[model samples]
Target chain A: MKKGMGTITAPWKQLLLNALESNSHLKHSSYFQLATVGCNGRPSNRTLVFRGFQESSDKFHINTDNRTLKIEELKHCPFAEICWYFTDSWEQFRISGRVDIIDGSNPDTFKLQQREKSWFASSVKSRLQYLGPNPGLPRISEHQSEEEVRLDPSIGPVAAFCLLVLDPDQVDYLNLKNNERVKFISTLDVNGVKNWTSERINP
Target chain B: MKKGMGTITAPWKQLLLNALESNSHLKHSSYFQLATVGCNGRPSNRTLVFRGFQESSDKFHINTDNRTLKIEELKHCPFAEICWYFTDSWEQFRISGRVDIIDGSNPDTFKLQQREKSWFASSVKSRLQYLGPNPGLPRISEHQSEEEVRLDPSIGPVAAFCLLVLDPDQVDYLNLKNNERVKFISTLDVNGVKNWTSERINP
Candidate 1:
């Protein structure tokens, strides 16, 4: 992975590295808009949290249960664009990439060994059809103990519908106040050699 | 316009009306991600500032120089989507609407009279050709004096692309918390009337 401000030498690799090293605050950012194409040819967007980034494999992952429309649509087409912005710093990054869904491997013993407990809990609760408009809908507190909820079989790899792995092809960075923006486009040939070209934008 | 959360009868209408009011903070919001369709059948997204909103007209406006790529693409196909989320509130709104470029009238003379001076200043600076390598750059130096930059008469009305209105056909509201996430999807017809039936989904 390479890193620089103006022209990205290795766009995808550099973005993966920068996203990983991004301030801890950014890592925890809750508002990321993902744009995907719908069957009607219109774009669909929804906000998702920045779950985490994996450095060694150079992939950014977000977990969603099998039920969400986005995950279901991705099963048919995997191209997507994700945008992340830090409101305080007026810094924004846009990643356009393809998504790969992981289902066979055990998330607990994943190559990165990064386990998201909250994601698991949410997935388990989601599968129960426990969510509805009424207050009487089953509550997490009523059914399972905290420990049981944490270690529930349904909350692990089996519970997850898909693990979205983003392989970025381009990253656009913009600093609002400075009025500076850069576009880094990545190119990888059949042999797997990767290259990136960066260009400064008039912001 | 409408008021009160429960005052609106239909669920879809209530959601869209609430979104319009809930996102009022967007009037003061500096950054917005506007997603449009590219000629290649891919979705394209970029950031813009929220200029103002006219409740009576049910229009949300964004200020941009006429020369921008967004403006160019918008002229060909006016459909677009805008997403906004506030930190203080976990509420996030996605509005998919249409863009209408108004050129004959002074954009500032519209609903944003309170911010005319600031808007005028920005309009002047934004007319300058961005020096960077990227296309359709954002405006730089919010503090730059409008007096220093000469406005080109040819670029007067046509130069400022005001109020990319989104007549929302569909809106999705996502409220996320530590334990539960509530998602609602509402769809409307071309006349902006709600379809009444909305799906509550597990996120």
Candidate 2:
């Protein structure tokens, strides 16, 4: 593990924090693959931008269109997994978690605040994504270009904007270059304090 | 889709084949994330090397340890998904598939032949992966380095070596640059000929 990472003492958590801090892969790219199980029990995966990470909460945040099929699938089954690969470090992190969708109506003040902050912080191009036709729907024209679809005057943000917060139950961090792997399992107590149990595992 | 430069005709398949041909991400790195459902119905994902692609059969092959939790997970549920992000192109492909494991003892001659060919094509470093300690097991010491663990003379190829073939039922291709997404669903006819149905979808 990277040394002197005093904020997180646990090896697995430290490793993850280290990757997020210094890894060029994570630094340059905000994208990671998200996996979720459909109602039919099939696993589906797609690339999603990693919006935020809270070390204390062991939570990951990603922005998605509320109308996407994955969102519908997540509604039926909250179980989800996300994988981030750091090419420069040859490290991969697999996080298994339960997803909670936070729309404008979410009761949690902190979460609602986060959603609002993130929504405003996002660029017009990014916000335009929520405005476009419902994701995964078939297009009407083969000749319809992306720019045309994106810039269509009729497009405007509706109520489908959503923030998905994943509270990881288990996180597996693998350093392929080192041939070392570590797993961190997190639990929250009655007081809402989070604790992590970590162990070094084979790669 | 790049047209008239013509090899693959199908737009979605052409995009994938083009990515494989020219994308620096796949060329410089062999790893892609694999997602599968655990017996309990949670999704799990990890990075694995992209060993081979059989275009004619529309299948992908990856070699892995048979004893891994993922292999066991695949046993319980054949449904799987893989995600590939091409950094240079800013494109991502999400492939949803059914997995089949093939070992040396498989009945099919063609599969056995492919295994042997792939085994011989692999490097000593790649071969050493199959010889390592069982994946996901706790390590004895924090000081234990990868080289020490690998150089252990006792380590050698075991029955754990296995090949995974993913027959994708659906492939979703997303080009971030263009903000365009396409879905290709494959079907098998009575004559055993595979066909693809492609449609442009919202990104």
Candidate 3:
């Protein structure tokens, strides 16, 4: 079959939803590798949890700390990609997109609202990670109370808390059961309108 | 403890070996995400299988088709990172390194020998993938015979078969079991000797 294009949003959203449901039993299914180009064009990657999409749109959500190295890397280069694998169905999704960081310094009110909403939606344990000392910093003591962390749900996101929204331009969906692959590409027009095209490719 | 410096080789090799032993039951534990920078500084990522280290050294091995997109991406930018997550112990390793591609065109017989050895080590199914049409091309048929593919192991690597050697300079190991993180940095001295330093860090 020929490639098909769309104008509204990412075409792989439905397939991704199906995959998520199929592999809901695995906790790490939501965990994916977020890769960014660091200083001097070196590649940096880390595992992060999927915070779901914004409403029904393809704009992805990920809550991170501003003090993390990725924040600095993203500041230098906004282009990034996330590679996610679902072991149950043996599905792999490589999504390449441009990341927009909404931190304490962001001026966009709408983006800030989304960040606020994400922070409140997270579990107390998840929110407490942001409360801890900056990631990668030397740990002074061994005891970090996984049991004692208590954050007020009403309190908004702290200063270090940041939200990353990835506007995906391409997605490579591969199923290892048969090693079937599909590529979905999205291009923008002059007025900033996104058009998506999907094609079945050899694995 | 404070940071440690080693002049011989990567200190994290022991930890990685321990991880591999602990998660030997899970098949996908051998899989990880490899991220590379594409044109215009964009980031691309995909899943790949780990082919173990080179003898006692930390030099990583991965086999890929030369015609794949990463071969071109690596040509422009050899810097890449592989993020591996172990589900059993909740450990993640982020290894950032420069990749050396040893394809058919490679001049070094030594590197080509390694490539040949890797091809011989791979299964018949893996070897047949390279014989198929180029990656990302439209699939002409849906049924690709998964079985009934046989190749003699004594034969050498095909022209499309390529070996990737990742010489890591930095490794970030995070154990979510206790949220304990360690940063391993390797610096090359003037004589091309690598010195590794490790420090306990916050997750």
Candidate 4:
């Protein structure tokens, strides 16, 4: 499997890798806006915590409840986008790609290993979300706290855990400090080797 | 023409109205991520400043340059969503709605009036964005700075200013402080009058 951002030669890719690796801004602001296509061809967006980023293959990693609307939306339309903003550095990254869902049922051990790693990485407090009632549905009760539900004997890992792999085919980087924005479009050539064409765009 | 965040009886509606109206957190961080559906059936998102919020009809207001890809995306798919997070209050709001784009060619005076008001509301620095070369396109020059581009005599508003009205049909509010989340779904019943249903979801 592809690993660190070291092998990426493209400037935009290098920049994104540096951001995610250095933990300057991307690390501090772990949450990003996730956008998905609805059945009616519209977009639905919500904020999700950034689980991981791998620069080698230009992939963003996030976790979600399998029962959420986003997962259902992805089943119909797997194309998705994620936008991240580093407020301290005044930089914004818009990553667009087709989603590859990796759940416990996937045949590949790599995906299963990743899912297990994510589960272990999550703290008790964080894991409580997945253990509680399904997202977007009515709450169990108005007064029940998340911790209470998590502590309930009936709840454990709560079967709805899934890992989403967003393989970015396009990355748009905007440096708002100087109004300099750039885009990197990835395509495979005749050799089937991935390549990216970068250009400076009007902000 | 929804005026203010007043007259909304639903608890989630009232919560959103209060947040936008109070401006404690929303005002401090005026920018939020705007998500749209691309023709390729994928999602695209970017950060844009919040122009206004009218609670009466659950509309979120924002402006964009007509030449941007977002306008093209919205034209093909009018359904969109916006995600706002008030860091200070630890509150996050995900709003989904249909878009109503208003431009110079639009006939409605109310929309036109709103557009004019937005124009008047913008500062010279803020208006420079519309004056620049089309967004997502190649930059005008490798050496030209945004201020230099703004000061150029040839550049002006370029008639690319547009107002986008997001008439929300669903709203999800999550309070990270206590892991309490709620959803407000707006529907039109047999009478064709808008009504909202509120529910507390497990976070």
Top candidate on lDDT is 3
**C-alpha root-mean-square deviation, candidate 2:** 6.0
What is the C-alpha local distance difference test score of candidate 1? 0.55
DockQ of 4: 0.73
Candidates in order have lDDT scores of: 0.55, 0.74, 0.86, 0.75
Q: Calculate each model's fnat, 2 decimals.
A: 0.27, 0.91, 0.90, 0.93
Q: RMSD of each candidate?
A: 7.4, 6.0, 4.8, 3.9
- Highest TM-score: give the candidate number: 3
- For all predicted structures, in order, the TM-scores are 0.68, 0.86, 0.92, 0.87
Candidate 3 wrongly placed segments (more than 4 Å): A1-9, A142-150, A189-191, B1-9, B141-150
Tens-digit lDDT track of model 1 for A1-203: 22112232344445444544554464335457777766665666766666655444445677655546676557556877787776656667888878876653545445223334434534455534322222212233433323343344454444444467777777888776676677777777574655667777565
Better of 2 and 3 by TM-score: 3
Error of 2 at B197 (Å): 1.2
| Residue-level lDDT for A142 in candidate 2 | 62
Ranking by lDDT: 3, 4, 2, 1
Residue-wise C-alpha lDDT for candidate 2, range A1-203, written one tens digit per residue: 21111234434656766777666444335668899988898988888888776434447778888888888899999989889887666678888888989887788877777777667666666776675676889887666543554443343334788888887778888887766778888776675445678888887
Of the candidates numbered 2 and 3, which has the greater DockQ value?
3
Error of 1 at A121 (Å): 12
Best by DockQ: 3
DockQ measured for candidate 3: 0.75
